[model samples]
Target chain A: MGDVEETVADVGEFALIRRITGGRPKGAATLLGPGDDAAVLAAPDGRVVACTDVLVEGVHFRFDWSPPTQVGSKAAAVNLADIAAMGATPTGLLVGLACPSTTPASVVDELSAGLAAEAARARVGVVGGDMARSDTFVISVTALGSLDGRAPVTRSGAMPGDVVAVAGKLGWSAAGLAVLGRGFRSPVTVVGAHRVPAPPYAAGPSAALAGATSMIDVSDGLLADLAHIAEASTVAIDLVGGLIPVDQRLIEVASALGADARHWVLTGGEDHALAATFPSASSVPPEFRVIGSVTRGAGVTIDGKAYTGDPGWQHWR
Target chain B: MGDVEETVADVGEFALIRRITGGRPKGAATLLGPGDDAAVLAAPDGRVVACTDVLVEGVHFRFDWSPPTQVGSKAAAVNLADIAAMGATPTGLLVGLACPSTTPASVVDELSAGLAAEAARARVGVVGGDMARSDTFVISVTALGSLDGRAPVTRSGAMPGDVVAVAGKLGWSAAGLAVLGRGFRSPVTVVGAHRVPAPPYAAGPSAALAGATSMIDVSDGLLADLAHIAEASTVAIDLVGGLIPVDQRLIEVASALGADARHWVLTGGEDHALAATFPSASSVPPEFRVIGSVTRGAGVTIDGKAYTGDPGWQHWR
Candidate 1:
């Protein structure tokens, strides 16, 4: 007989839970982990930061483009970045996954491994989860965080004169998506960036400590997310085109594809870079670079003019 | 034009979010609510209790049988029950909702209303949530709770000499399901039980305060879930059949349907009743009634014999 591949139906529900959670390493904050009805985690700051993000199969991702492992890690990364944007340290993640029973057990295994790997990187645990059957595959992850006694830097805190800086890679995922859309995956770096995002998790709390006025996770394009801060804080922002750094790698890929690199840098989404407003340029951390300043007008602008590029990947639009 | 029915797409993602969360009441623990990247909730006890539960459109509930509001409340009830099972009081909830773009905005609004009504009853809030578009409708709720300095009562704490008891309704949801399956809806009580469970939220912490050894939320029938506690605690339990209470309403419905009410009482799921083990009968709280005794064996027994009835509605099977 050829190697017999097992599906989730073959193993049943409780056994699958045991397989997913058994022998998984625990994080520092996991007072109680899976196998019980609920999990307990240390909050430390007398408060907890929480957020949720959902990924659907055909809409949010495709198996042909990315493996199940990358999908799982992407799920964890996206939700954890929300905690970071709140200027908090994540403690654990709870995943609610629904998929067809006909799906191979290997897919679920690899996906769980990916989630574990990302949680490990963030020094947190996949503390709890639920599994169900559905025609459409959906993974919902909720991230819980501890603020470590630092006040949350909200989007409404930005002042007119505050400096806008960003920490981590920008437009990498968008460029990678462009490459994949063109049916080319030769550039491993760009392709891999699309499959997985490395959000700057630590810079959030560091920026909070350095007197950040406002912050956001750039998952809906840099300019669009900045517009969110502007609307919430009732202030305007202006960015110098020269000050906005477009990486050489992205520029090369854009040139090959006959696309505008500057547009991608300004309006691309899903890189999960951290954007924050500092009181002054001196207060900006080394991880972040000043790209603009909050101004006394209405919305985000390029130097003085409105950026008229395509608003790429606003998410759910 | 006949008043155009608004779909989620017509309302757009941001507008739908505002309609779902705007002006909704805040809970006692809600330090920060929706519209932020993440919500902040008071942990109070230096630690937080958490759990997640996912409900799919066809797999978990049907719109024809239960209204959208009930589905929403059911989602909240199930996740909040998990927190109560941990001997903690829930502080707030984070929801991740995925549905088709064509879904009615009114359906979304009523569902949000259901979630809010239940949260208000539990003295918590729908603190934050995410909205996404998909072919199937899925609701994933994460409940966070505080222990109030009480030690968590895990399933493994049942001892051989402990007294077993239960709080809240049993077999009501199952009877309701059976009633609905037979094409009858007169018994609104039973049908409503299936749609929204009134899980004894306060009884859990009370059980822990009464020095209860172990506890669980019974969403998988009495025997099946008791088997979990038995396996986790490495001990058997024997229930006195005379002590088991089958509601008069259930008996009335079962008699008319020519079904066995006892079997329903034994193996019915989704009533979300709380079960616990105490050192003695006197230690059991007023909310609970003594039904069995823990023994030095491995599984659950009904009047010292193995129950051979049908195991109804095991989730994800």
Candidate 2:
């Protein structure tokens, strides 16, 4: 194994655990960190918000497109965004990693670093985790959050006449993905956006505090996820095409790649933007921009009609 | 596609999620169940104990050896046992499942049923989960527990002169694994033990209430797990060989298989029994039987000496 780059098996499970968790700083929400049977976290409001998300290699990410650290960040970001979507701030995270025994130890180290990077960005830590041997690389993350006495903003809470708004970038990830898929990787900002989403975690709780009627994370595309809220709330949502914020940078990249930036903003997923409904325009938070409104109908639409695009182009589904 | 059973891909991701969570009975601890971005569970003590465990198809369990349900149960049981080891009662569970797109939908259904069965056994619920397409089948379960204001029993609190005790059966799973390895599955008792572990969840808090200093769930085998306690507590442990309780049924199984029952008891993995150290023998709870004593030295020993058996037979490591 000399200088040949030791694999996970070479380092052993316990040793690998040490490498993954050692010296990582835990936040105040963490009562007891790693090296115990279980990690104890502060659930200040007497309730814990939990959700799990799994990312499979090749299916969810490609190593050539995103390094281990970015992939790790994406995994943690996805689950942490879920917590935020529930109008809660994340307290801690638990990761379950399974990779082939021959996987380079460096990959695990870099991935752990990436997870810690994102956890730190969210003001938390990887409180606990487990690693195992598998034929494929799979990362499963569980994020826990505290509501701080706020009622969860579920998908079913929006009502007719509520204004729909969003916080965070919309189609940057999709634009970046398109650029990467075309075998060109310039405009590092867009590519970076695709690899690591910067979810507006604070906007969630702020929206809840501002009397948000409903909230969701944009994981399965804007229209698709909006449709979820529409179905759940038994209402219809119609987005103003002009109001959908298409970042200028994305437009430039889209033009260079010969793609429609607006379509990406409408149907591309993985941006992890927070989308919520407010009872009135005045109730909307500063970070959120008004984009649509809810009505007494079913399904999501563009303006007053259904917008049809390439169905097979639904990359996330 | 006619006359063909549906695969998970055929039902789609969101539909499969509904199949996995719909109609499931949520426990009292589950304040909000599935169909949301995250789940909210009651953490009555204002603190939550969490841990994660990953089970890979060929690495942790073989479908040929155990059905999907048992494998699912095993996955949940391992994480729940970790929570219990901390003197906490599990409140809710989140599962992250990844399997091939071609995998049968029925397998996912039965596996979810098995997870629900075990979660029900623990009086908890599978509050939320995520499913994805992967090249390998993987089940990652995270268990959240409530301490109910009790101090968490950790592995680093044992002091010199403490009495060592254990609750629940040992070596049974090992014997069962042995029987299965021989391709002889007649003895349903042993074989089943290998498939599903019955962790003594209540004994953890009972031990803590009885002033037990340290505790750990026996996962890596008796001696190996005790070593974790010894190293963490900075103390030595010596087990009385004669005092070790090898179940008579296990003895019969081992005898019929020409294997040493005591060795299995001493070194078996995955039984999920609770091993604890109390201030004195009198403080040991009714469910626990004293087996040894703590001392002022380092490392774990058997009958005041290091016991060495066949090396490379470590099935778990």
User: Which 10 consecutive residues of model 2 chain B have the lowest summed lDDT?
Assistant: B308-317
Model 1 lDDT per residue over A1-317, tens place: 26978888777777776666556788999999998999999999789999999999987778899999999899999989989998999999998888888888898888889988899889999999888888888999999999999998889999988999999888888888889999998588988888888999998898999999999998888999999999999999999879998999999999999998788788888888999999999999998999999988789998789988787564456
CAPRI accuracy category, model 1 = medium
- Looking at model 2, the pairs that clash are none
What does the lDDT read for residue A162 in candidate 2? Answer: 96
RMSD of each: 1.2, 1.5
Expressed as tens digits, the lDDT of each residue in A233-301 for candidate 2 is: 999999998898988888888788788998889888899999999999999999999999999989998
> Local error of candidate 2 at B266, Å?
1.2
Chain A fold similarity by TM-score, each prediction: 0.97, 0.97
> Candidate 1, which segments miss by more than 4 Å at Cα?
A1-4
Interface RMSD of each: 1.2, 2.0
Q: What CAPRI class is candidate 2?
A: medium
lDDT of each: 0.89, 0.90
* Model 2 quality (TM-score): 0.98
